[model samples]
Target chain A: MSTADRRRLLGPIDASPLYSDITPKVHSSVGEAGKSDKEVRKVFIKTGLVSNASGSSYIEASNIIVEVSVFGPRPIRGSFTDRASFSVECKFLPYLKQPQEDLFRGDTHANNNGRQGLTEVEHKISQYVETAFLPCIILEKYPKSTIDVFITVISTGNTTAPSSILNLTNWIVNCSSLALIDSGIEIKDIVTSGHIKYLQSEQRLIVDPLENEEREDALDCLVSFESLKNDEIVGLWIDGNQKLLTEELLSKFIKECSSMSEKIRANFNNYLLKLCEN
Target chain B: MQEVDQISFPPEVLSRIAPDLSLERHLKLGLRPCLRSFSEFKPIAVSSPALEDEPNLVGSSIVSHGQTKVICGISIGVVEAKNQSDTLNQNETNSQDSKSDGEYDAEPVYPVVDIARGRTGAPTEEEMILSQRLYEWVLQSKIIPASALLTNPGVAIANQTSSSQGSSADVTILYPEDSDMPDLFSRVKPYKFVLYVHLKVFGRSGPLFDPCHAALIGALKNTRLPRIYVPDSSIYSIKIPIRSRGNFGHRVKETRIFIDENQDLSNPLQLNKDNIGGASNYGLYDLSPGSTSMDVDPNVIILADLEGDAEEAECMSKLNLIYNPNKKSINNISYSGGGMVLTKDTLKQCFKLAKKRAENTQ
Candidate 1:
């Protein structure tokens, strides 16, 4: 019983790619020269993009582009439950190459087929977003229902930073928060996340760092918070070598991450205020 | 009697319906559902290199943490280096850490984790997440050196002077540093061994990440890669029809590599032992103000080495740390606060306990 895709035609094995003589244009990096590391790249977020979905949001920050749609609070066909069941599914465009994907996910043979199940990177991102939102959403309000979040990654940016996924996760969390709000879901508070890269040797923390050099060892941390709930952390992910970690260093990461989250929260508030005006 | 049955149920029943209440009851008794203390961890038992004897496996390990068992086996494959200088240049520019110093290169292992739950289909979400995280951590830690898997390809030469003229050809191997190139060496392409890790978990209990990581490092410590070689006549050019709009035909040269069957000629895989660390998981649970009989001011308790289904479902706020004892350093930390807020004190406590556990394991 062969399960291979028979409908879709695969390219010839010996076919050579058509070459273009025009040289590729390199886009300037998000953080231009002389820009302060404390400042983050300008983000463009808009909600209600998908007409068919209950709620949708499209966010573009630098080269990373993400679209999230929220569906549910709709009735389920299964047995009755006390609280709404929540699930998140994330997928990247078949052609979109994830950052350092080769190192983490070596099986590129199955990449050409669009019908394949979610890759490891997509599953991981989905789990992170799901974990972050589970505590914030008041699922009990919509009993015997289900809430599903579907995220589509259009582009993952060209940054080679090891923390690129964390950056993408940060944006996805924020966009999902907006989609949830637009759906009129009864969430406790808005969940906004912040990502930072900490350089051990330089003793510096770059808020919303977009790029990482291979020569420099950095501690990348992403923290999500529901600010209204006593600034409680809803989710957290930290990556890098632990040898550079100290009690003070860990404390600093949290403090910096929360501050960054606070800034994003202010931006969201302004956006929502304008949304009300219209 | 019917009302009484509804009010009070069995321990197992209660654990399933209301896991939080069940956990609180256990905590009041100064023990967990697994019968271990709040700070106690399940001791790890590693199998005595039994899988190392398998001919197909380059290295393998079976680790049991209490009731949970994880089996990890590594296999090898050879890949031709597309451009040798490109790899060398990247290594030169990226040299920073003492573990992955510019002199040697480091690559990640391809890992696939399968937890036997009596079901066979696509990998579960847990398996996919764990496998991905494991791969990322291995690369970030820079434990596996590329030089260790870099093969010294042997070139076969015909023994014309020997009486047995049609017998096996004499092979000459070239090491990485060898610069004295013969005419045949120019055609010889550099090759590297890729390690594929297969992890199988049984008696799955609690968070599988910690034990899965332990088993992988355990297996990697014993890996010995076999020598590989390419015959002098391995490289051949063939013309294939190009179906593109601009091209008519193209010629491609390919090489076929083979592994040496002689067991004694293998070399142990070099690993950055100092950077290798074991993972520990802790769940933070907040005591409902006055649930406990004892008056503890700081109600948040960090439970070490989480086990069983009740604790996993109840404790949404988790702290996972990978600590290296030799350097007394932390390699990775993933803490998610589902309910309880992670205070500085709680974070420090987890690090302290994780470091202690790592040191004791060594």
Candidate 2:
């Protein structure tokens, strides 16, 4: 499609394959395939909120700021298997006393070691990461040891922005890279994630939902993408309670994945080249 | 100079005022302009007491960073307990005996009770810490002779007396030392006290006075009480002064303004508040008079660290301090708040009135 046609399809900031609006400030950051940001004329569909991780990018859509830091590909020590292991620990500042009483008791204690604040929101974000991102990254090359990734979501900004998955994905990658730097690790590629929320009120599709919209809107979908050599699922998420999805909408969410994947892969490849040169 | 007995400001420290004065001299030498020539920085002679006042008391007076009218006074009150008397038992209260960090001794039950009887505002954090420090100091030291805590049999300081389970030192007899040990023991000497201190910040009537120094001054004047110092014992003590003036303006900092009787005040410790500077502290001359000095130790006085312009320009202004602790550099200025440091004539009048009152009491 031409630039004008793509613009028409995306329709103002509110038009999307999801419910929340794709904010101009957030959308412009993602690069369009076969064309740079300026060259592609800044399409409304690009994952602009995706944060640059060590090797990964986390593009947020709902009310959260997720940063992913990736580490390792460092030499393994003990186990000699063809697979590598990784772990993630998330933390929140202590002073933020959450209001809801029910949100803290019983089941909440399982994940909480008293005050090591991996808050409820982090729990949701991490669930997606463990389910999606871990499968794609090749661990077999460095079999024995562990690669630690820390995903921190500083603020969700009133639940409007697709800040959760976006920033979580961002920090996991960022901290992982820092860990890798500390451990002297190298990697082939980075990972990235994107999200879209279904807004029932406006009948409009929004790419990245602000915190307010997430509170007000009905349904949302999040998808994370990493470059795939073969047709295997890697680092990604497909979170949506959007029941009545047209075939067209599903295709758009999936198709949008490829373009995001290519950008992430290019970004990682370029970053690796720069790092190796340095 | 007397042999080393207690910590005090050095002569050079006295010379810091240029009109070098000892504690006695500060009071008797009268006031002279500081070499700084800022009348507020004026120094007076000071020399500790030779007469036995409050027995076994230790006291000191350090001119504060401010010469304001602010004064801190400490007085000890003796009360006979109805149940557990004051801590005079030979029993050592150690951390090993502590069930937990915050728990008090169970037998004696020395409640670190605070009396708020005629007070207005809630007590400040500093005041609480000061009292707690006193409590710990008492718990940790042997200064207060355990004998004074002896209870008179069958007598307690209650309005009515109960025949059984009366308030006495509940001595638990363990094995009775082959069953011949006495069940009750009495003190050879008697003393009971609760130290009540008042740090009065007179509404800025006199020159700018450092509360810390005034606190020391308060301690110095307090030496009118009797103190004890055994003959031939080397006096190792510290004089702490709260540092108020600094780059940040009011960050409350305190340094041990250590003083020694024989030593010059030229060089003394600059202790960081809370004893952070460590084991290297200063010493002083033993000021205890005669045989009483053998049994009595000077009562302790710790000054609150100096405060900044926030307390002066702003905080004190709110209190209606007539003189500003701000602007004027802290020195020897006399303040009039609390009415003690009015102009010279008025001050003389107030002193005369106090003297008359003392005469009446006598």
Candidate 3:
């Protein structure tokens, strides 16, 4: 028996994990493949929900539910910087199973040793969101401060595939931008993102593909853009299975994402217009 | 700084500076800071069983209540009885012990709660309290029947006596109850399995007990106990010389057991399903006179599934209830009226709401 933990109650020391005799059940396909390539799920966006935060926004797109809260430009007691330092933290509800968690949950080979810190998935999303909004936010205006964006994934709609993350990240980026606008932060332009999947077998692209339609050979691409700044790309992330990348194919993928971004920008424009009128 | 401080602060700023006042203002509008109304619980989603193929896990579940999520995984361990003679009268002694203890024949699982707050050290007070409470409640409810944890061991032998001495290629496993080996385990002591629950909370936005309990119950409901057996081999002793340590050789006895790799022999762990109930939490806040539409007597409002800092910190009186609809019974109720009085009517209301939640979860 191992020594007891003085501070906490630790269970038995001689216990071993019980083995199972039954085979796992195979899940049936959810039939999301029938969704049209050009169609996107209905999106709902609301701003200023968290009463205590400087600014907040909640978004529900497809099966994913996300909330973003911005707290910052508040004073810091440490060393000062000429421009505000920006950071993004993305966290999923512990029970909201991550996409392809079984394949990629732990960074090392520790497997089920109980991961610490942010999983690779959360870190990548936070990094991308931060990079996407870095240029849009006028960080120089708020000198010697920090602007922090906290993204909380409320649900992933029970998706288990890895490709669903691209679609989810796209929504998170858009929601964060709305939260920034709500915070009344000085920014150069609103940043919006789009996701598309290229199917190798079909030789076609599906914009805003559903989770069920993801295939091992499909190429998933997510791009964030500042539409007002001549559609300049601020962030780009691509996940490919086995397809060889060419310059022409990459540009084609970018073009599809930019068009999707345009559509999202138009919707945001109308929503902002209604807010101004109200 | 002077000019900014002189003007009245924004509503968000006021919430931070004076949460009590801000909460009262929102309650007047029939909404909490998280935009939830009184008596409305955050909807919860329970994912299917998880980590089924994990070698060290018997069962796992993930449950999400609003923005908070709790993942629970149950691993198992085995311990032998200290007294080798106890196996003969284990059942009778267990009942007698229960009678003397004034409790049922149930076992509480060991649970460890790790809430990720971007820091690492000993468990925080909130985690410890939640874990202790869960352990106590599980025992009080008698959800895990102790009898279900008793394990039976089998032994494997070569079918052919000649092959057993030679290549040993024809090994045949025989359980204690097998007709060909009725007396195989007559002198062996009985072993019991122990369940250890690991709960990890992420993005916690409010009180954690309710969600943690849900995840625990879900994982237990699907738990399956594996078959373990003792090896049919000699208990040979080996002596190892330790020249470097300058010590005499010590004898090491071999008494290791093995878990059956064949999953077909595994059995679903039996749980007292009727005692398992949905847990709902309520915060009692007084809508004082002249607040909202109440102008006379102080009205007490019960908010279900408390969320956000303002409610968690400002709500002085709290109640946690677990109701089982199948049994039409209230399994547990924990109330802490922090310097506040709770009327009988408020308790009755909470029970009613608890029953409704139980029925919905069922």
Candidate 4:
């Protein structure tokens, strides 16, 4: 059967811990899991968008599109005297769940019958970005300040997993940094992000999640890799109850995040070179 | 005046730029030790450090500047010697000759120059050499105050004074009347600290050459990290690859710092104090710095690249850098990928040209 048909028969893909078919989600786990035809997806960089921003770009993967705009290092607005400041705001459509109908409604993309607090999802992003990405920046010079970044998920497709959000943001931030430069803004480090999800029962690891599998997930986590040399994990987003998360899952997630982050980093550099041409 | 075509240096020659370029290119110049022009690097686009509570300045989205450009933002931070910490960070370093705190109880290490240079090519031997030279100058110098870098005493200590500013990060310094100022631990003196010597290289690879020779002149001519503190006095010798007909250590004289007539510095290069900015075609430098003599003559010599009329090459020259007592004449000679060091004459010339250009542009 074709990929779409197989997923359809898998019955909308739910996290294994909650709904234990433990088989379909297992496909994503084995990734190179001995399946002769399994293929890995990639993230691509887009430039020349987000005019209001100093630096901006978009990263698109299967079922996910993240656009990031980089602005200022300009004399920050508040009491930022000697140093710089960064502010991050992430928003999902109010109806983040029920991805299918979630896309049908207004800009808010009503889903979950207009339920599921977006604040939780957005907070994960903010916390992850602040921890993983900030240290990579030279905070000493830009003292007493904030550099603000606002991310809004304009569209929600079926299954925008936590991993997808982290990967997309890393991709977006990297592209946005280039965008920031196109606009003549300064940058301290070149940081990228990635995420991995673990299925508790089957020990299945999903690289980037779509809405369907994520909704079914028992435990989900997000990691942002910030530095190139250190391969440092700058941000971490752990969803579901922490106790439900296992050691095997954490190890698998970190390994996958590191490897994928490197792949995406190469692409980001290539994009920057294209930017330099003009 | 035909807008001279770009000059290119041999790949083997360019490697002298440390961690600035990758290796294979270093093979082109044969990994010879020398310096290149700042503009000569491949394109370099760097962003300022990201601030917490602010958007990330660190992103994979790089602002690409076409061509290989190495960017060095040379920031200067000065604080009194008494307030810094004694230990230095891993990157903090100075020349081998720096005076130790052990030798003299309180001698201030002069402001050392640290360079954080970046470029497209993997780091070359020359880049490493220059980085080391600049590193040693700061790590082992007598100018920086070790006391200022100390944030806590083994254990994290809160500031005795409260943050009347009412901010979460506010830090206040206080000393009681009975406090002994002589205690080296006190953190009050305004120590003059030169944080890091940021260097950037642009353009493709070439032979050993002078980088600061142009940008310093241009910024002076055209318009214009943290860690331990050190002085410039302690450097005994600098390590550099010898590029000569015979491969061996050759003796090249010292170069000194350039001080303009307008400088409010305690002391400066006594030679031609009136001579401001001049000399563009040559790579001149102030090797020695102190109150007694100006622009110290660092006897440690190496090759430098010079670009003019589309021809780029390195030069080795004999000169007194420490406040030249003899301002009589300069010996001009030609050698394989070598020429004269950045003499006072060349500097004065660049300054003149840059000043004139700045005026016309304005």
The lDDT of each candidate is 0.72, 0.32, 0.75, 0.37
lDDT of 2 by residue, B1-362 (tens): 86988756676565444332343243233322222210121222223322111111223332223333223333322333433433333244432333233333321101111211112234445344434443343343222333332222211122123444433232121121233333322321222223333333322212222233234333533333221111110111223343454634444322111111111211111111121100000001122223233232342110011122211221121110111122221111222123111234433333333233222221
Residue B98 CA displacement from its true place in model 2, Å: 35
Better of 2 and 4 by DockQ: 4
Error of 4 at A78 (Å): 6.3
Q: Which stretches of candidate 2 lie over 4 Å from their true place?
A: A1-82, A96-102, A105-120, A158-188, A215-217, A228-232, A235-241, A257-278, B1-362
User: Model 1, residue B301: displacement in angstroms?
Assistant: 1.6
Q: lDDT (0-100) at residue B290 of candidate 3?
A: 42
Query: How high is each candidate's TM-score?
Result: 0.51, 0.31, 0.60, 0.33
Off by over 4 Å in 3: A1-31, A41-75, A91-113, A152-168, A178-186, A211-218, A241-243, A268-278, B1-124, B146-270, B273-362
Higher-scoring candidate on lDDT, 1 or 3:
3
Score candidate 3 by lDDT: 0.75
Residue-level lDDT of model 3, residues B1-362, one tens digit each, is 55555667799999999999999999999888888779888998888543433444667888988877677877666777544445556577666754554344778887878775533457799988998999998888888877677776776554544633423345455687654656777755578877777787766788988899999998888888777766555321234443335555644443444556556887888887867898999998887734544232247778999998899888888999999998899988898857456667788889999999978976
Candidate 4, lDDT over the whole model: 0.37
What DockQ does predicted model 3 obtain?
0.14
Q: Give the Å shift of residue A54 in candidate 3.
A: 4.7
- Output the better candidate (2/4) by lDDT: 4
Chain A TM-score, each candidate:
0.88, 0.55, 0.84, 0.65
DockQ of 4: 0.02
Which TM-score value belongs to model 1? Answer: 0.51
